[model samples]
Target: MATQTSIPASHDRDFYAWALESANRLRAGNLAGLDLQRIAEEIEGMGRAEKHALASHLKILILHLLKWRYQPTLRSLSWQLSIANARDEIAELLEDSPSLTGKLPEILARRYPAARQGAILETGLPAATFPTGCPLTVEQLLDPEYWT
Candidate 1:
């Protein structure tokens, strides 16, 4: 699908070339030009990206749940679908990285306030009405049977 080219000198200059070069070096057992430091850093960055994604999805899930709870009369199929989708995403993330289970509670706590704010912005609800702290436990939020 594409032409092969010489590896770029620096990873910063061309990331695609850098990755290809790194892989080629590793496969060829040529450690001389292999960027071990940058490769390790990139690996760690990928893990952090996944954690951030989990946090982001958790925030969105809680926001929709708050709206569903606080604005019962305004609930719609879209909100239902959003909650289900978020749960599904969260499950997939946990399945891929089960160590994240230990961080779930703290993540939920950290994201809850922002989620409430989002709920207010989206629903036109006053901030005073929502709980100061998270109302749903992480388990409850993740439970498919919990929402009615």
Candidate 2:
């Protein structure tokens, strides 16, 4: 059995130390000494981080698709590579957290506007050049062979 330290690690002051100590307590079955509230919050934070990662990758894929469709003259291997990479990342995230598949519609709805604005900014094209909303479905956005 691991002995508890006289004082608990401060979560805010030193997060790495707190995490290590928490892990030690858990390994030792010292539930009474565990910081349950902060541990729960940290676990929830991890889930939110995964969700944000999915949204970010979705935005990148959508932005590249918009660029590919609206600015064919400006297309480069960089854009194609980015689109491919985003699809791979999204696939990995879904594999790791299958429940996140249910969140795709919400993620797309929230990320598409940002992606559209990004396309306008990155391409210096008029906002009118891009559609007001995403024209593609999640399936199309993630399709490895779907190039517009």
Candidate 3:
């Protein structure tokens, strides 16, 4: 059997405080939990263009957070700063890549079909007609060539 050590209550409280602060920032930016829920509904209703936009934003945010928090080598404050900087660089690449911009929604839809459907419906956008030009696909995003 595995034993678990209890974390101090103060540590839990501090963690909650930091999480709340982050949530507040997201809310102030119109990206609250409720807003995200609404966006999920909108995804089902959205036209292809709107769905694509939302998907792109979501991906960028996820990638940014991953880069910021999960870099294997960044254990110290300075390395963490480097992670943040790398996230920014990744953001820039996403913004500038036309191929990626087009396929964002398809990637999301394939990756999270239910959530994508809900978002389209909530956004009140018409059904999407995925264009042929988009470079990102459900498969491609999952197994990215660039990353490989």
Per-candidate clashes come to: 0, 0, 20
lDDT digits (tens) for residues 4-88 of candidate 1: 8864567888887788878887899988867788899998998998899899999989998888898899899999999999999
Top lDDT model: 2
Q: Score each candidate by Cα lDDT.
A: 0.89, 0.93, 0.44
How high a TM-score does candidate 1 get? 0.88
TM-score of each: 0.88, 0.90, 0.22
How many residue-pair clashes does candidate 1 contain? 0
User: Comparing candidate 1 with candidate 3, which one achieves the higher lDDT?
Assistant: 1
Per-residue C-alpha lDDT of model 2 across residues 28-112, encoded as one tens digit per residue: 9999967798899999999999999999999999999999999999899999999999999999999999999999999999999
Model 2 residue 62 lDDT score = 96
| CA shift of 112, model 3, Å | 7.8
Name the candidate, 1 or 2, with the larger lDDT value.
Answer: 2
Using TM-score as the measure, the top candidate is 2
Residue 53 shift from truth in candidate 3, angstroms = 0.4
Q: Where does candidate 3 stray beyond 4 Å?
A: 1-46, 72-148
lDDT of 1 at 97: 96
- In terms of lDDT, the poorest run of 10 residues in model 1 is 5-14
